[model samples]
Target: MTMSSLTFLDRERSVAGPGYSRWLVPPAALAIHLCIGQVYALSVFKTPLVARFGTSETAIAIVFSIAIVMLGLSAAFGGKWMERNGPRKAMFVSAVCFSSGLLIGSVGIATGQLWLLYLGYGFVGGIGLGIGYISPVSTLIKW
Candidate 1:
């Protein structure tokens, strides 16, 4: 992605134009929230994941637990940085982290390596989830 897309450093230009509708922001935020919130449904695939990976249910559940833990950690630690850098950069980074996690996790699954799955979906993706999760809240508050 281009630098402009990742970082909206210019505070003035980042603001909504005069004709913009404030009401539209909530729906947009809701869309993002809905997408991120799907992580909670990982349990739905627990049985299939167990069979595919030949692992116990507890092992598979670690992925969810780790990601959730990291989400809170990153949000708490990264908040100040996100504030300084603005939501655009945070959101972009989050998107990259989350997307990369899925890609890497796929590789891990294909190779039957549980560690890769944890690293990808838990550590890295969790960071993305945390940052992306908070981005809209900050932006909406600013608006």
Candidate 2:
């Protein structure tokens, strides 16, 4: 977390130098934002999820609700940690969490477990979304 504790994903190595171009940062940020923004497409699966889970529409909606709520909370709380740790590390962590959440959700869907879906795509993935959403902000501002 500290400069002395920098690891492979640490931001120290990524620090823009005199010749660095700010243009590159926006593309990287946009790419990440685009990936994280897929959650906005959750509605596309709404009816299918409801049918697959044999649950009420409101129940299925909770999954998205949870994800959105987690996104807000994580972004609010994680912004500082993202800054302190640097975007490189934050992005890696976000990717891991988001991917893991998707895997977990897949298993849940196969096993027919609603809670797993809630825990995975909703909670875990949401954290990824939040961190990913905020990680680029600091870097963009720094430039």
Candidate 3:
């Protein structure tokens, strides 16, 4: 994409000016964190998910395991990318991934497809978790 086509998410455009509110960073970062942290509440759905997918609790639990694993992996690997590109892009991508993951995982739940849970809430959401996590910290530091 050309510079002209760049969205607000572009680091160049997202950069704060002299009057920018550094105080705004914490609230925004907190919001992102709250959204991402919701994944931890998955255990409450374990029994329901097991019934929905006709799977054992262990199998359902694997979804959480995958998500946590991917979160770690993505954070470890995605840090440099976040550093190079800046936080706005990373957080936007993170939001998309997270929301998409929830949608996809819901579809999986609706359709009784176990793998979709693994792919959606597990893989995609985990990427979101990682990116969402790092973006704010980096951005706050920069600010």
**TM-score of each model, in listed order:** 0.89, 0.91, 0.91
The reply for model 1, stretches above 4 Å from the true place, is 1-12
In model 2, what are the clashing residue pairs, if there are any?
A: none
Steric clash pairs (candidate 3) = none
Task: Report the lDDT tens digits of candidate 1 across residue range 39-102.
Answer: 7988998898899899999999999999999999988988898888777778888999999998
Q: On residues 1-143, what C-alpha lDDT tens digit does candidate 2 reach at each position?
A: 57678777876867777988778988998898899889989889988888889999898889899999999999999998887888888888889989988988888889889899999999999999998899888778877
What number of backbone clashes does candidate 1 have, counting pairs of residues 3 or more apart or in separate chains?
0
- Candidate 2: list runs displaced more than 4 Å: 1-6
> What TM-score would candidate 2 get against the native?
0.91
* Candidates 1 and 3, the one with greater lDDT: 3
Candidate 3 structure, TM-score to reference: 0.91
The deviation in Å at residue 31 for candidate 1 is: 0.7
lDDT of 3 by residue, 1-143 (tens): 67689877777777678998779889988998888788899999999998888889999999999999989898889999988887888888888988888889999998899999899999999999998888888877766
Residue 143 alpha-carbon offset, candidate 1, angstroms: 3.4
